[model samples]
Target: AEECINSKIHEIKTLEQVIGKLITRYNVLEENKLKSLVNIYEKMKPKDAARTLNELEMPTLLAVVKHMKDSRTAPIMAEMDSIKAKALTVELVTRNRLPFATAGSGEGDG
Candidate 1:
């Protein structure tokens, strides 16, 4: 019985270590992908990027734009459809004001 308990504890510890590594890797990958998206948007022409960005999911579009500099994003926003631009602006504004909002921190969100 003692042997079994020791084995189980060891397994749990190993699993925890693996999970920690996986989380670190995932965070790195996400940061890299965001940087890539920012670069792509920055280099693309404003109107072209606006059209492409409008087709992205709102969450995705926001993620890309949120990392970008104001100088890079302004021209793109100018080229965007007014309604879409306004809606995104509102979300950005809200996010800035409530950076720690917990409105949807429950399970099943992912």
Candidate 2:
């Protein structure tokens, strides 16, 4: 009877260890899935997308702007009020380092 009880106790301990490992693996997978979903959602959100574009380094922003269709680009730029649009345009033109153009140059001059 004593030997039987020892075997049952050992089985219970082994079962508990298995359950703990499964729980650990489940938690890791859940965390990874949540992180991936959050990243995807951030990329897909229009506001976040605009902010990301606004924050990109000048060279990268220029490259992205060059490839974007004007139809798509105009609305995003227009979403900001006039002042912000002008500021961002100036920033893009100056590589984020200088003020907007002075009055001398006509719109078609360049």
Clashes of each: 0, 0
TM-scores for every predicted model:
0.82, 0.41
Give the top-scoring candidate (lDDT). 1
Per-residue CA lDDT of model 2 for 42-82, tens digit only, reads 44444555666666565555555544555556666665455
Instruction: Name model 1 segments beyond 4 Å from true.
Output: 99-110
Per TM-score, the best of the predicted structures is 1
Instruction: Give the per-residue Cα lDDT of candidate 1 at 25.
Output: 100
Mark the 10 consecutive residues where model 1 has the least summed lDDT. 98-107
- Residues forming the 10-long window of minimal summed lDDT in candidate 2: 37-46
Off by over 4 Å in 2: 46-110
Per-candidate Cα RMSD to the true structure, in Å, reads 7.2, 16.2
**CA lDDT, every model vs. true structure:** 0.90, 0.63
